[model samples]
Target: MVVTALDLVLAGLVVGFGALVQGAVGFGMALLATPLLALIDPAWVPVPILVPAMVLAIASLLRERGHADWRGVGWAMLGRLPGTFAGVALVVLLSPRAFAAAVGVVVLACVAVSLAPLRVRPTPPLLVTAGLVAGVSGTAAAIGGPPVALLYQSASGPRIRATLAAFFAAGTLLSLAGLGVGGAVTVDGLLHGLLLVPFLAAGFWLSGPARVLIDRGGTRPAVLGLSAAAALLLLGQAVLG
Candidate 1:
């Protein structure tokens, strides 16, 4: 791919905003990236978004040591591994249009589930089930937050944000590995993902100061609004697509 000045500038801006969303709410990279990038080549969306979000998460961790339940994340990842293989296999078998359509519809579904009025704390079965959803969504769309985000309680804001950040990072790493094992992720994917790390870091830098009071309840409306808009955009695209 050509390293045009415009590409860096545009990608930088997108990544910066993505970091702010992630920094502020601890999730939203793919939620923010997908609907926006679908305006360009929808196929170009996932890796770039993941690259920045991963970096943003890394940067967010620098502010304070966000304690992550490594055990929970591991269990979730274990459940997702097989599903990740399934997703990669599905991706390999599907056309770009078909993949995009499926991703859009499923993203909308995750949004609905995350925002459901009847909230239920996840049990062992449910957590593993959510992991499956995370794997499929992450593999298909690089947008996996809604599934596992629902697993965290909003009241426990610190744990919610910290754990979700860890989960997002873990999910991406797992999916990236799956893509490699399945021969879906190419050298270009890895190279591109690494190359975008600077933009991701820059995004995190811009959002650094804002992390001070990120746990406030005020952020929910905006998060949900962006999510709802993304879902609606994805839904429309899926239908018309």
Candidate 2:
């Protein structure tokens, strides 16, 4: 696909906005960028987006380093390895439309889980399970934050943001590796991702002030609303397509 100047500009802006959302909240870059980019070209989905996502996750980790939970991050990564393999298989097997629809369904389900009033302790087993879910979601759709985010919903904001950042840093790398193994990470996607880095940085920088304004209870409502809306939009697009 030809990379027009407009494509670059639009992609940059979209990524920037998504990055801002992620910075203020915890994770939504892929959820916000994927469907929009898919409209530009399907080639811009998982691989291209994952590049900036990894960058964003690292930046988030550094920004909120004090609140990271390394043990939980470790458990998540352990479960993510096999889930990453499963995600690669799904990518190789499913048609584009079918893949999109499946992703939409899973995202919607995750959002539903987030919105529920259920209480979940972050036990090792549950963390591993969340990690597995995140691995598949991250690899397949670049929207892996929900499973882990939902699990940590009742925690402090800093912990939630920082811990998620840590997990995503590792998870995004694994997803990229999985994509590489599947021959999905093309040169064009990488180049496009590089072009959007500046915008992502800008968004992350701007998020600091916004984060201060977000109240304690605001995170849950914001995350849940955005997740549900994004899932609905994804599902609607897949269904209509």
Predicted structure 2, TM vs. truth: 0.92
Question: What would the TM-score be for candidate 1 when compared with the true structure?
Answer: 0.82
Give per-residue lDDT, candidate 2, residue 3. Answer: 79
Tell me the TM-score of each prediction against the true structure.
0.82, 0.92
Candidate 2 worst ten-residue window by lDDT = 95-104
Candidate with maximal TM-score:
2
Per-residue lDDT for 44-98 in model 1, tens only?
Answer: 5666566666666655555544566566666676668777877787777776556
The total number of steric clashes, by the backbone 3 Å criterion, in model 1 comes to: 0
Tens-digit per-residue lDDT, 16-112, candidate 2: 9999989988888888898899888777787778889999999999989999989999998988999898888877787656766766676678667
The CA lDDT of each predicted structure is 0.65, 0.82
lDDT of 1: 0.65
Off by over 4 Å in 1: 38-43, 62-66, 95-117, 212-214
Candidate 2, pairs of clashing residues: none
lDDT of 2 at 219: 82
Cα error, residue 179 of model 1, in Å, equals: 1.4
